[model samples]
Target: MKHNRKLNIFLIIIIIVSIIPLTSCIKDNVQPISKTEYMLGTICTITVYDNKPESVIDKAFARIKEIENKMSVNKPGTELDAVADAAGKNFVKVSKDTFYVLKKGKYYSEQSSGAFDITVGPLVKLWGIGTDNARLPSQSEIDEKKSLINYKDLLLDEKDSKVMLKRQGMSLDLGGIAKGYSADEAARILKENGVKHAIVNLGGNILAINTNTNGKPWNIGVQDPFKTRGDPAGGLNVTNKTVVTSGIYERYFEKNGKKYHHILNPFTGYPMDNNLASVTLVTDVSIDADAMTKNIFYLGVDKGMDYVNKKNGLQAIFITKDKKVYVTDGLKGNFQITNSSFKLMDKK
Candidate 1:
């Protein structure tokens, strides 16, 4: 009886030790706090994998809404609208957030040599590409709007944080870069709230806050521009980085057997007629990645590759209509093509 009692005590100790780890595993696998909202004209999702309460995610979403309210062109009485309303009149003071985005937009506009301009708002509103009233405008209408599409006319009074449009009809539509900024802001909120790992996705502007719950890099799927959403042509492993794609498939309308995308050319006041279907930029900052997409796409595959290779700490992938995947030298080994239909090109 004494021997049996000793064996029973040993077995109980082993069982309790095993169950301790099991409880910890259960806690680790608790469903991450995920929240989704539609603001800024796109689906925004903030997912946290830690034990943090849902308030953290809500705070992130709130930050995005604040940014949208400040910079949204569709919303009247917004800071962006105030600036546009005062175009060619007087400089309007804007919030620090608005001014910061405008400054970044102008910098990229100049860097891309006006291939991507923040002042393309006039042409964007005329075409109404993503709106219900989208239609093709006459040649004269396009030319008239194109004249107001120069980034040089966007005057920034840095000292006062005031902005003015040199032309009366010029508008500032941040559709190109606002979401990226919002995503970054959301990530900031999550981090400040002690979220160690999270995914902040504002439409296609995907930002990974940190590694996944598994302590590995997050896997971000590259949208197949030719197919519907969720169909990935490839996948990229990213950690604490953002993956932004500027593709013709994102926003477009069909008219009389022809398809017109939203990424308009500031120079010609028309959709960019390049063979490239999409351009994906991988970087640490979502705002930079967001605006750079248009600039790189405008340059096409060859020049775009050259532009990306010249820059440090930046990588880009250009997917051409021919189904050839051209990745920058930095992303050569990092990018993997999942779809057999699309082939990865060899380095030149």
Candidate 2:
């Protein structure tokens, strides 16, 4: 039998704010080559402004599909699913790529003190937030899954390149970071193809390859969380950065007039209740930006700002439910407020 995943239960994938080329409407001297495909359960696009061959774009998407096949828990017989099926039994040796991602996932899970747990698969399945099975689980069910949700239980052997989930019921979901990793891989493929400039968008995990053909930074619109999708609260100028946002509005379900979002708290095993409407992370690595959105959201606005402020390369734009916005030091000069409704607040 085959497993058919409509929402993938563990798909942390969401279309956050997207990048908009400032001169997108203006015709360029040289036309850019682009391709869009539905992969990783999301629409992905690769646009190369260097007039690279269509084969290069195909290669990038092919790499993304390869990553999806290896890391996606939705697919049966995948390396990740095989490890999950054998959890608490024995170590399952995996490919170098899968092992590396698992190692990185564990690292972030530890850094966030289990707040961004990669082992939240059980909890995710219980709620089924984005799938046809979407429903509120009973208190006992939530507790049971929560008990199985522990990042510390995921063991990795570097020498053998094997992984083991300490509990039999535990599952691994890389949806949180897999898309970002894929976007990074796509960008690398374009760069390797000698394409000087491109934009890799893996369902809104935006990675700007290089500066624009005009030698200017790419303009990325930060979505107004309270407003429509294309509405921008502000814009960011960047050369080589990945932008990702996680918000309550991205995915949700309403039952009995109350809404349940997909961003589950590792501690409570429920939707996170916070003042933040959205948290957009700007970093050089797409995977970090993707995982950091959830990690920073776990910290809330104040502590999240403190964490990003101290980081050497990471910057954040936090929008609260009250419509207040705050940007880290690195983006203060590069980010411009374009909407009057959004008040840029001082980081305290």
Candidate 3:
């Protein structure tokens, strides 16, 4: 009986020792927290590496939802709707969120010399791009709507947090910059909650929280303009940065064998015609990258590169119609061209 008891005790000691290593391994491998939702007319995904991921993720998403409710023009009774309703009549008092976004949108409009305009809302509604009603508009209609698309008329009273559209028919569309702003806000929330690693993908406006959990830079693929979605023309390795791509491929329609894309020129009231197919901007803030992309796209490759070069801390990748890729100096080593059919241009 004594020998049998000794053997059982020895076996118990071995079992506990074996279980320790397994438990330690499991504890070290923390699964990433991921969640997705439909918002801002596209899928917004948030993934974070955190000890208490649920709380942080919920807080991050809440901020995005708050922005959408206040800024979305599609949603009736929103602050944007109130401003549009009072256009040419009175100033609409808006929440701080709406005021900040509109203020920044107007700033971009001025910086781009009207190349990017938020007041293009009137024209956007006329074309109805991305909606089932999308169709080619007659020149007369285009001209009429073009008259209402001026960013200068968007008045912002910062002291009182108000917005006023100067003309009766004028409207404000935050679609261009809203998603990027939301992504930035979500990232801010994540960091505030002690999340060290995360990825905020708001409709492909990607903001990497920091380096990947593996301690390597995040690799983001730039979509191929002519191919199906998720097809990569190149990849960028980045850490703690925003990568946003504005391409003709994003929203478009086919009519009479010709393609009409959503990026309209504020000046011409027609789709911006630059030979370039897509422009990707990398910057510290997703909002700036998102707002500046259309301006660069309208500028085309040459002037676009000049604009990107002059801006401190901004890098751009311009993919042309002829399958040539022009990358700003900052991205030379960081951007890898994955598609063999595309040629990386030598420095001009």
lDDT of each: 0.81, 0.82, 0.82
User: Between candidates 1 and 2, which one is better according to TM-score?
Assistant: 2
Model 2, position 8, has a per-residue lDDT of: 35
- Rank order (by TM-score, best first): 2, 1, 3
- What shift in Å separates residue 124 of candidate 2 from its native position after superposition? 0.9
lDDT of 2 by residue, 1-348 (tens): 112234532332233324456445223666888776778766677888886679999999999999999998667789988888899999999998899888989999999998899999999888877566778889999999999999999999999999999889999888788988998898898899998888887754888987888888889888777653456788888888898878765566788878787889979989988898899999999988887788899899889998998888999999998889988888888888888988898876
**Cα distance off (Å), candidate 2, residue 46:** 1.3
lDDT of 1: 0.81
Cα error, residue 223 of model 3, in Å, equals 1.2
Model 3 residue 328 lDDT?
Answer: 92
Under the 3 Å rule for N, CA and C atoms, how many clashes does model 1 have?
A: 0
Q: Find the 10 residues in a row with the least total lDDT in model 1.
A: 17-26
Cα RMSD of all models vs. native, in order, equals 13.5, 4.2, 13.7
- Between 1 and 3, whose TM-score is larger? 1
Q: Kindly give the stretch of ten consecutive residues in candidate 3 with the minimal lDDT sum.
A: 17-26
- In model 3, where do residues sit more than 4 Å from their true spots? 1-28
Per residue, candidate 3 scores C-alpha lDDT tens digits across 59-78 of 98899999999988768899
> On residues 249-346, what C-alpha lDDT tens digit does candidate 1 reach at each position?
76788777788889999988899999999999999999999999998899888888888888778898889998999887777666788889999988
User: How much does candidate 1 score in TM-score?
Assistant: 0.90
